[model samples]
Target: MQDHASPAIGISDLPAREEGYVDLRSYAAIGDGRTVALIAHDGSVDWYPMPNLDSPPVFARLLDSENGGCFELHPAQAHSATREYIPGTNVLQTTYQTGTGKVRVTDSLNTGKSGRLPWGEFARRIDGLEGTMELHWRVAPGTRLNRVSPWADSTRQCPLLRVGDVTLGVIGCAGEELNFSDRTVSGTITVEAGKHRLIALISTRHEPLPCPDPEHILDGIERTVSYWKSWSSELHYDGPWSGEVLRSALALKVLTHSHSGAIAAAATTSLPEDPSGGKNWDYRFAWIRDAAYTLHALIRFGEREEVHSAVSWLLRMIRKQGPDPEVFSTLAGELPHSEHEVDAPGWRGIGPVIEGNRVGGQLQLGVYGDLFDMIDLYLEGGNVIDQPTARLLADIADRTCDVWHQRDAGIWELTEARHYTSSKMGCWHALECAVRLAEAGQIEGEAARWQTERDRIKQWILQNCWSHERQSYVWYAGSNTLDASVLIHAMSGFDRSERMSTTIDAVQQELGDGPLIYRYTGMQREEGAFVACSFWMVAALAEVGRKAEAERLMAQLVPLANDVGLYAEMIHPEDNRFLGNLPQGLSHLALMTAALTLIEKY
Candidate 1:
C-alpha cells in the first residue's frame, strides 16, 4: 500500500514555485444563485455545472483535464494574471496582463432576485483594460459524466443545446461559428480598451436553438452581480476571522440547493482529497456530517435564515427515512440503498466517479452527535427545534445508547467496521448534548439516563480505545495504529488525561510528517497528510495547554492555504500542493474552530 504513494506516473518534478497546472492557485470562485464555478486567473471556466448545483458539470476540466469541457475567455497572448472577488460577493474578477494588452474578466451567477429557480445562468463579462486584445472563447462538451456532444442549430431562440444522457437543454453562447467538433465550439473576439463583450450559458431541460441575445444575457449578468452584492450584505458575521468566514459563508450558500436546502459536501465530486491515493469519494451528495458543519458555520456567521432552512433539510433526511439508518442522497434527500455508479468518467483518470455515497447504509455513530448538537444550536439561536427534530434526536440518542458499543465505520468512512474510538466519542457527545438540553430547560428526555450512557461511553473509550503498548489511544480497540483522529480527543472533551497526552505525542511522533498529519499510515493507502486533521491537531494542542506548539503548528497550516484562503482536503507532506476538493467545508470550519480555540486559549 505504501508503494501506491510513489506511483510510476510521477507528478511534475519542477520546483513547486514554477509549475502552472500542477498548482490550482490562479482561480477564484464565482456563484450564481444556485451553482458555483471555478474561474481561473487565465479567464477559463475550469469547473461549473448548469441549472443546478447537483447537475452534471458543463465545464469540468478540473476533473478530467482532457475530456471534460471548459469555457475560456483569456487573452490570446501569454499573460500574467491576478484574481480577487468584489467585496462581500461571489463575483470573481481575474485580470490578465498580456504582451499585447490587459483585460479584466468578471465571472458570476445571478441569484437572490424576485423570481429565480435554484438553477444557473453562468455569466462572463470581458472588459478591455488597455490596447486592443484578442480574446478566445471555447465551449467544449464532453462525454464524461453523461455529458454528450451539443446539437447546434442557430435556427431557434437559443443557438446550441448540449444534450447528454441525463441532462437536457444545456445552452451555450453563439455569434459566429469559429469551429465545431463532436463536443466543442471555439471562436476569437477582439475588444478595444473601453469595450466589453458578454457570454452566458443557461441549462434547461428543453434544448433550444439560437441562444438568447448577448445583450439580454449581459442584462442578466448585471442583475446577477447586483443580487450577489445585495445578498452578501445580509450576512451578520464580522468576527475575528471575518474575511475567511465570509468566503466560507458565500461558498456554502452557492453549494446549497435552494429548492431542497441540501448543502453538498462540496461543489465537486471525485476530485480526490488526495490525488493518486484513491482517497477520492463523490461528495456531490448531502452528508449528515457535512450538514452539521454547514449549520455550525452559518450559525457562526449569524445567517439565521440559512441556518433554519439547512436544519430543516437535515431533519427531512432523518424523518423521511425510517429509524433504520442509511446513506443520504445528494439532491433527492433520502438514503440511496445501493451504490450506483453514474455514467461519468472519473477525474484525471480517477476511475469510478460515483454519485451517491455508499456510506449512507453504514452504521455511523458520529451522526448521532452531529444531529443533537445542531438541534441544540438551532434552539440556542432562538429558532424553534421542530417537533420532528426533537423526536428524531431522542430516538437516535436512545438507539446510539443501545448500539454504539458495536463496531462500525469510522469518520474517515473506511471500509472495515470496528470500535472506532472517534465513533464512540461521538456517541458520548450526543448524550452530553442531550444532558445539556435538559438542563437548559429545552426539551424533555431521560437526561439522567443519557448521563449514565455518556459515562459508560467514556469508560468504554478509556478501557478499549487506549493502547498501553503504544502509550496512546490507538485507532480502535486492539490496534496499535496512530490516527490523526485521536487528536480530536481534546476537541470532543473525551478526556484531558494522560491518555490524551500520550495519544497526541504518539500521533505527532508517528503520523505527523513535518507540520501536516496523515489520517493513519496505510490504514488504507498512502495519501497526503489530511489537512483537516492537521488543524484538528492544532486545536487539540491548544486545548491541552500547549499554546506555543499550537501557535507554531497553526502558522505552518495557514500558509498551506492557496492564494485565497481555501484549504483542500489534503496536502503533499513534502510540497504543499492541494489534493482534494477546493474550499472544503471541513477544512475551513476546522481552521475557524482552531483559530477561535487558540484565540480564547491565549
Candidate 2:
C-alpha cells in the first residue's frame, strides 16, 4: 500500500467564478453503478450524493455555489481545460493546458470485485505531463449543507468528517500538514514533470472508519475502467451512428439501479426544464414509461441480461403492487410520495429545489401501452415471460380496454386530466399488441375481445381527434392544440396512411423549431424544447417513409448532445444549451430508437 502519512496543507481561497455557476453542458458524469458525481470542466466535483443517488448531496455546489459543498482540484493559475471519458468506460479524464505546462486528472468512483464498493470511494489521480504545475485541492464536506450539524474529529491515523450517521475519511494527501476548518479540508502541492499524486474520499454510513489503502484504491480504478469496457464490448449494435448509440446505452446503464434493476429517468434532479423555477421536478426515481422505453432501447441492441432483469423486476412490482400501479416508484418498487422542497438554492439561483415528484398519483393511460410494448419486444427477442407476468399483461390489456374512454393525464402527465388523443391511441396500441401476442401464442388473452376494443379505440381516435380545419390530429378532443406526443402514433403503428403523413407535416409546422421539437403547442414560448420530441419526430419521419428527411433531421439533432454525448431533458432553442435533468433516460432512449429506425430504413 502507498503511504498515508503525508501532512496536509492550509486552506486556500475558493476558486473565483464568472457567474458562480458552470453551464450544465460543461460537466461530465462518473459513476460506480450506485451513485454519480458531476465534474465540471474546471475540475470541481460540484454535485454528488454519498451512498446512493437519491440520498441528499454531500457536494452540492452545483445548486448553492457559495454555501453548498464541493471537491475541487485545479491548477492554481489560469488554464484552458478539455475532457473526455476513457473509451468505452465512465472513467473521466480532464486535461489542463497553461502557458508553461500541462496536467491530466483522472476521476472515477471505484468498483470492487462484486461491483460497486459497499463503501463510497471517490478517487482522483493527477499527473504532470509537462513542465511543473501547482495544484490546489479541497474536500469541503457540506454535510448536506446545514441539513445536519457536521464536525471534524481527529483519529489516531487521520482526520474524519462526521455528519449525522456517516463518516468520511480523507487520505492519500502529499501536501503540508492538513488543516480542518469551516467543515473543509484542503491543501496545495506542486507536481513536476513525470511525477504524480492520488487522493481519495472514502465514506461509510453508520459504520467504523476503514483505512484508505492507496495501492488498493489505485487498483480499484483500473478494475472499474475494465469493468465498464467489458460491459460496453458486449453491446451488439452495428448500425448508423453507432458511437452515439453506444454512448446513450452507456448513459442509460449509468442511471440503472444495480441491485433493483430500476432505471432512473435522469441522474440529477431539480435541474430546471425552465430556468424560471416551477418546471423543476425530481427525476431520480423510476417512471414506468421511462423504464419501458429504456428497456425497449436495450432490447434493440440485444442486451438480454439487462432486459431480463428489468422485466423481471417490473413484473414483480406489478404483481405485488398493482392493479393500477403509480406512475413512478422507488427503485425498490414502492410508490413515491409527495414532492417537497430542499433547502439548497436551485441551479443558478432558481429556488424551491425539489426532492420528490408529484405526478405519482396521476393516472397516465399511456403506461399500459408502454408496458405491453416492452413485453412484446422482449417476447419477440426470444425471451420467455413467466406465467404470472403473462397473466398480469393480459389483465392490463383488459384494463386498458375498460379505461380507454376515461379522462386521464396524457403522456406529458399534465395536471389537467383530459381525453388526450395520445392516451386513447396508447390504449388502442395496448389492445392491438395484446391481440398480436395472443395470436403468436406468447401469452393467453382474449384476442377477439381485444381486437374489438382495439378497433373501437382506433375508430374513436379517428372520429374525435382528427381536425379537418387543421388537417391533423389535435392534442385532444375539442382542442386545436398540437402535441408532439401524437408523433408516437406513427411509431406505434396506429396510422401509416396519408392522413398520418399529413399530421406529421402539421405537427412540424406548429411544434418544430427546425430539428428541435416542442412537447406541446405553447411550450417553446415558455421553456426549452423537449429533446425527446425531436427524436420522436425522427422516428415518425422514418416510419412514414421519409428516410432522407429523417436522416437530415437526425444529423441536426445529434450535434445538440453535450460533449460527452449525454442529453438533458430539454434544450434551449436559441442558445442550444441543455435544460432540465442530466443524462435523461427518455432523451437517450429516443436517440437510440431513432438510430435503430434510421438504420433499418437505410
Candidate 3:
C-alpha cells in the first residue's frame, strides 16, 4: 500500500500512441454504479462519462483516438500485459511484464459510503512486483470531444481541469510534481522493488468543485471494493457455468443505476454493429424488454432487492407516464429525447456517432409480456405485490388482450410494423401468466377472458405465422423468413410441442453459423451474429431436449466472451471481434439464462 497524498514528479512531454487502434475485445469495464469506464489492456482509460452514464463522455478516445481524450498510465518501455478482476469485484488488476521488470496496476471507480458518489472518483494503483520500472501517466479530458474547451487551473493545491461547468482534479502519492499543459496533466514516476504508487482522477459538476484529501480518496477505494465483494457474496447460484453466471450478474449490477434502480441495456453507445458504419444506436437508456430479461437472470441467482427496486421504479414510471410507456426511457423514467448525431468520429473512423435512441417511440408489443414476466418472477420469488401494481398489471393484461392482434414493431424494433409471430406469442405468454396469477389470487382479473384471448392469440400464430413450406414459424405473418426471436417460445412456454423443436432446427439451419445465430433472415450477410440470439439458441436447444447440442453450443458460445467474460451486443463472425455496445446486459443475461436452462434440464 502507498500513501495517498504523496506527490510525484511531473514529466512535461506526452507519449504518442504506439498502437494505431485497440481491438474492442481488448477493453474491460469498471463502474461506480452511476457510470462505467472502459480500460484497454495497455492501461488506458478510453471511454468514460462524468457525473452520469448518459452524460457526454469526458474520455472518448475509444471513438476518436487522436482528438478524443483519455487517461493513460503504462510502462514507458514495451511490455506484455494481462488483466483480470479482483475476484467477485469490479476492481480490475492488470500486470505488465517487461524484459527488465514487472509492474501491476489496479483500477477502480470508487463508490461512496452509502451509494453512488455525487462526483466521479477514479483511482489507479501501481506497484513494482519485480525490478524497478519507469511508469508515465497522462490525464487528458476530452470535454465531450472539444465541444467544450478545457482550461488548466494551477492556482489550487493540486492542478484542476476546468471545462464549462465541470472540473476535474488529479492527485497522486509518489513525491513528484505534476506538469500541466494543453489541458493535459502529465507525470512520470519510477517505482523500485517493494514500492508502490497511487494516482486518482476526480470530477465534479458543481462550481468550486470539492477535491477531497488524497487519503480520503484511498479509503473510498478500499470501501468500494469491499462493497462490491459483499454484494457478490449475497448472490446464491450453484448451477453449471457458475463462474460465468456470476460474472454476468456482476456485469449487470455494474449496469444498474444505484440511485434509480434503472438497468441500462449497455454502458456504451455507437460501437458500430456494421463495419460499413450504417447501424449504430445508443444503448445507455433502459429498455423494458432488456430490463425484463436482466431481471429474469438475476432472479435465477437469488437476487431480490435490485429486482424489487427495478420493478417498483418501472411501475412508478408507468404511473407517471401512463400504461403505454415508451419502448425505452431514461433511468429516471422519462422518454429519451430524439436521436442526434454527435460530431465525434466513431470507433475505427465510423462516422455519425449517435446520442439518443430513436426507437423509444416505437410500439414494441412484446413489452406487455416483458412487464408481466417481470412481475410474475418477482411474485414467484416470494415478494408481495402492492395493490397499485396489482391493478396496473391487470389493466395492462387487459390492454394486451385488446392490442394483441394489431401490427407493430416486433422485438427487434425494426421500422416496419408487421404481424410478427413472436410479438403475438409474447402477448399469449403475458395473458397466460396473468391467468395463472389470477388463479393464485395474486391479483384480481378475469381468468376466463384472459384464457380465451390467450388461446385466440395462439390460434392466430398457428394459422398465420407458421410456414408449412419451411417447416418453421416465420419472422411474421405471410413471410417465409426465419427469426431467432421465435426461439423465445422455448423459455416463454408459448409452445413445447415438437413443432418448436423442428423450428429450432429450422432456425439453426437458416440463420446459424454453427452455435452463433443471426437475429433474423439475411442478417449474417449484413452484420455479425447477434450475441444474445446465439445464447437464446442455446437455451432453446436445451428446451427441446437437445442436451448434447445445447452443451456443445454452450461450450462454443461461452468462449466468445472476451478474456474477462464481458460481452458486447454483437461479434464479428469472421474475426470474432466484439461489435456494438459493450458489457451488453442483454447478451450477459441471455448467457445466464442459457446456462440455467442447461443446468436445469440436464
TM-score for every candidate vs. truth?
0.88, 0.95, 0.95
lDDT of 1 by residue, 1-602 (tens): 00011111111222232222335544467665466788654566778776566677767776666666677676788666666666566677767677788787777675535736334567778898898888788766554455466554343454453556323222334455456665555678787899887766666554332244567667776776667666667766443455655665666666677777887777777666545635567677777887886686567556776787788777877787755455457666855544566655455455566655667677888878777777877778877665666676677767878888788888888789988888888889889888888787666777788889999999888888788888988888778786787676587677776677778899888888898888885732466777778888888988888889988988787766665456667788776776777656677767766766777677
Model 2, range 342-414, lDDT digits (tens) per residue?
8777788887688888897788999889888998998999878878888888888878878888999889888
- Which residue pairs overlap in candidate 2's backbone? 7-176, 8-176, 8-177, 8-178
Q: Single out the weakest 10-residue window by summed lDDT for candidate 2.
A: 1-10
* Cand. 1 TM to true fold: 0.88
Global Cα RMSD, each model: 5.9, 5.2, 4.8
Identify the superior model by lDDT, candidate 1 or candidate 2: 2
Best by lDDT: 3
Error of 1 at 24 (Å): 4.8
Q: Quote the positional error of residue 17 for candidate 2 in Å.
A: 3.5
User: Which portions of model 2 miss their true places by more than 4 Å?
Assistant: 1-19, 143-145
Deviating ranges (above 4 Å) for candidate 1: 1-27, 115-119, 144-147, 156-158, 165-183, 207-216, 234-241, 273-277, 340-345, 497-499, 523-525, 600-602
Candidate 3 lDDT, tens digit per residue, 31-68? Answer: 99899999987788999987788988888898888767
**CA lDDT of each prediction against the hidden true structure:** 0.69, 0.83, 0.84
* Ranking of candidates on lDDT, top first: 3, 2, 1
